[model samples]
Target chain A: MKQRFLKAAAIILWLLIWQILAMIINKELLLPSPYITIKTLISKMSESSFYIALLYSLFRIIIGFLIAVVFAFILGVISGLSKNAEILLSPLITVIRSTPVMSFIILAIIWFSYNLAPLAVNIIMCFPPIYDNVVKGITNTDRKLLDMAKVYDIRPLKIFKGIYLGSVKPFLAAGMNTALGLAFRVAVAAEVLANPKYGIGTKLLQAKYNLETAEVFAWTFMILLLSYLFEYIFKIIIESRRYNAQTRKSDKVI
Target chain B: MLRLENLTKSYNDNYIFKDFSMVIEKNRITCLLGKSGSGKTTLLNVLSSITDEFKVKYSDFEKLRYSYIFQEPRLLEWYTVYKNLQFVLDNTHMSKQAIHEKIMDSLKMVEMEKYADYYPYQLSGGMAQRVSIARAFVKDFDVLLMDEPFKGLDPTQKEDITDRFLKMWRENRKTVIYVTHDLDEALYMAYDIHVLGEHPTKILYTSRNAYKMNDTERENERDKIWQILRSQI
Candidate 1:
């Protein structure tokens, strides 16, 4: 309860700073006050286009993130299990890590349709972290436990599920936690370039063109909220699975 | 019987054992007594085919199943005591009911049946090692390899675990190769004791004590074994 109060206090302090800055600027077109931004956001919620744009942007970004996560996990396992795969894939992963997001967004716009541009950018943005963390997790599994498994001649599937999954889950969760935020940011940037039919990025671009600073802040606020919500949900899922695995104990065998 | 001829194992540039040959008898506890760095675990690793840099001339031994208990308990932390035992049993063709009964029976052997629901971290060092013992026994292997499984216990816990281990071994009669650096431990556990010497890794002494000896006889035997080990040093 005390921690909750401190967190609330910290948020209010930041809002106070923003409010003061907006008052000093004294121009809604240049820097909108927090009140104007919140008012704009609440009014925008009543518009059907707001829901449509929000949902469209949310679906595309989330779908792209999930696809990247799945592919990254499979690639990580392959790279971890075989040296040849690691050698062959290292250069591609390095290039993806080194390249700028804007460069990818430009290339994606040129190479693909507007609908796929954001997804391609999000996938390229999310893959490296997930792949690297998962490979590290797999390669760093306890050798003693593995040796014990081998001595018992445990089946390959059991080894993968029992030992490998137990070891890799934390790294995967961490990677996803970091990648989710980057996915949202990159997807929004790509959508702004591609100017999709209905998306938060499209609204953001329109607001900017019209010099509606309050609308820009409102859309930015929505993106922040969406990113936080997804991260919180992902964290709950990972932690709950870990808790269940740890706390599940049966006195009688099953 | 298990036999290895001309066995050579090395890590990097250092050889722990070279051209080593030994015979392990069937259905008896053979303790390999050696100092800390004298390749006791290396020998067990070789025998279990974990590293696989050896030539074995065994009589149907390679076809038989094997289990290992390491220096630590090595129980999976994610699993409860019951599940740790069940993890190995799941590999077999036994019915689920049979596996449950077997796990219960084996847990009873180590007197850990009441704590079957406890996780590994919830257990004390001694209790965790007992669970590992139960896990090893539940596998129902023809041979069990132990690498100082009771290395860090207090005297009371050590004695209790050793007695419990021997009781389980007596009931199953599996061939066991127990490794230890302590002379008293080897005396307490082994039907045969093989003392290992360093500087090329060969057996310094071999004693066969098939029958239980009284305290006086055991003391005399300890003196004889000590002399042999001391001479090698």
Candidate 2:
């Protein structure tokens, strides 16, 4: 309870600082006060476009993230198992890790329609971390346990389920958490550039272009809210999985 | 009989075992006693085919099923005690009910049937090792290789686990190769004890008690084995 109170207190303190700073600036056009942002946010809650924009953007980013997860996990398992695969995949993984998200956004815009540009950028941005973490997790599996498995003549699929997944799940969960956050950020930025017909990024761009600073702040607040909410939900899922894994009696199906 | 002829193993240009040969009696408990770094575990690994850089010609390698009880439990943390047993038994032709019954029997052997639902993390060290022992026994194998599986147990816990191990071994008399550095453990566990020394990794002494000895005789044998081990040190 004390910790909860302290967290709320800290957030209110920051909001108060923002309000004071806005009052001193006395320019609603440049830096909207917290009160104006909150008011605009409340009013926008009733707007049908707000839900449409959030839902569409949320679907695209989440679908892109899910697809990237599938691809990364498959590639990670292959790379982790075979030295030749790792050698072949290293250059591409390195390129994806090093290249800027903006460069991918531009390339995505050139290759895909406006609706797909953000999703493509999200997948590209999210793959490397998940893949790297999965490979690392599999690589770091306990050799002794593996030896035990071999001596017992455990089938390959059983070893993959009982041993490999036990080692990889935590790393995969951690990587997905980081990848999810990055995917959201890059997805929104891509949407702003692509100017899609229905998205939070589109609404954000419109508010900025019209110099509605309060609406921009409200939209920014909405984005932050959505990002935090999604991450929290993802965290709960990971934590519950970890908890279930710890408590369950049977082998987890990988 | 399981004969490991002219076994040679080296790692990173360091020869841990060179030209080592031993005829391990079938369906008998054989303990490899040595100090730390005396290639005891390396020899076990070679026997189990876990180390690939060794040449060990076995007498009946094709007809053997090998199970290992590692120094650590090595139980899958995600699996409960019963499931760890189930994992090794997956390739067997047993029906699900038969496998479950076998798992329960093994757990009962190790006195861990009550912990069937407990995951590895929930187990105490000795309890986890007992689960590992159960896992080894639950599998259908002709030989069981152990690498100091009882290394970290307290004396009482060690005695309890050793008693259970012996009881289980009595029921299923597979060729057992147990590796350990502890003298008392060697004396307690093996009918045949082979003492190894380092400086080139060779067998220094081999004591075989083909017949069951009384406690006094065993004590005298322990003293003799102690003297042999001391001379090597």
Candidate 3:
């Protein structure tokens, strides 16, 4: 309770500073007050176009993220198991990690239609972290436990499920958490550049062109709120899964 | 008999065993009592085929199945005690009902039946070791390789676990190659004790405890084994 109150106070203090700065500037275009920005956000929420743009960006980004997860898992396992595969893919992963997100967005816009550019950018940006984490998790499985499995002549499927999956889960969770945040930021940036037909980024760019600074702030706040809410939901899901596993009761022996 | 004949192993030209030939009688508890770095674990690893670095001329032990109890409990942290046992048994051809019966029976034998639902991290060290013992016995194997499974416990806990292990072994007699550096552990558990020396490892002394001995005889045997181990240093 105390921590929550302190956090609320800190946020209020920052908003107060913003309000004072806006009053001193005395130009709405130069700096909008927090109240005006919030009012614009509320008005946007009443428009059907707002939901359309929000859903368009949300679906594209989330679908791209899920696709990246699948590809990363398959390639990560291959890289983990074979030295030749790791060597073969090392340079490509390195290039992807080193290149800027804006560069990918530009290339994606040139190579594909504007509708597909943001998704392409999201997938390209999210793959490396998830892949690296999966490989690390696989390589770090306990040697002793693996030796025990071998001695017992455990089936290959069982070892993969019980040992490999068990070790990889935490790493995968962390990787996805990081990639999910990056997904939203890169998706919006890509949309702004590509000028997608219905997206928050397109509306944001329009607001910028019209000198509607309060609307720009409102759109930016919406993206921030969506990103925070999605990440929070993901964390709650992972935590609940772990809690359920830990507290599961044994079945009665007949 | 299970024989390891003319077995040689070296790592980076540091020979752990050279032309080592040993015979293990069937259905007997043979303890390999050696100081650390004396290749006891290496020998077990060779027999289990965990390491393929050894060159063995001939061995008929490949037809047998094995269950190993390592120094640590090595229970899967994600699994409960029952599930750990179930994991091994699930690979066998046993019916699900039979597997459950076997798991419960083994857990009861180890006095860990009440902890069937507990995860490994939730158990005490002694309790975890007992669960490991249950996991080993629940598996179908022709031979049991125990590599100092009771090394780090307090004396009382060690004695108690050893007694429980012996009780289970009495009911189900399997060929067991027990490895340990502790003298009392060898005396208390082995039918045949092989005292080993390091640096191109080989057995220095072998004793058979087939007949029950009085305290004086046991003490003399302990001293003789202790002297042999001391000489290796």
Each prediction's DockQ against the real complex: 0.45, 0.55, 0.44
User: Which candidate ranks first by TM-score, i.e. highest?
Assistant: 3
Chain B of candidate 1 versus the native chain B: what TM-score?
Answer: 0.92
What lDDT would candidate 1 get against the real structure?
A: 0.87
Q: lDDT: which is higher, 2 or 3?
A: 3
Query: What local lDDT does model 2 show for residue A141?
Result: 93
Better of 1 and 3 by TM-score: 3
lDDT tens per residue, model 3, B1-233: 88878888999889988888888878889999999999999988888878777888888667679999999999888778899998887545778788889999999999999989887777888889999999999988999999999987898999999999999998878899999999898899988888888678888888886327678888999999999999888
lDDT of 3 by residue, A1-254 (tens): 99999999999999999999999997889899999999999999999999999999999889999999999988988887787999999999999999988899999999999999999999988999999999988898898888899888889899888898888889999999999999999999999999999999999999999999999999999999999999999999987675245454432322
Q: Largest lDDT belongs to which candidate?
A: 3
Pairs of residues clashing in candidate 3: none
DockQ, candidate no. 1: 0.45
What TM-score goes with each of the models? 0.94, 0.94, 0.96
lDDT of 1 by residue, B120-171 (tens): 8778899999999999989868889999999889999999999998888888
Candidates sorted on lDDT, descending: 3, 1, 2
lDDT by residue (tens digit), candidate 1, A110-229: 999988889899998999999998898899888988988888988989988878877888899999888999988999999999998988889999999999999999999999999999
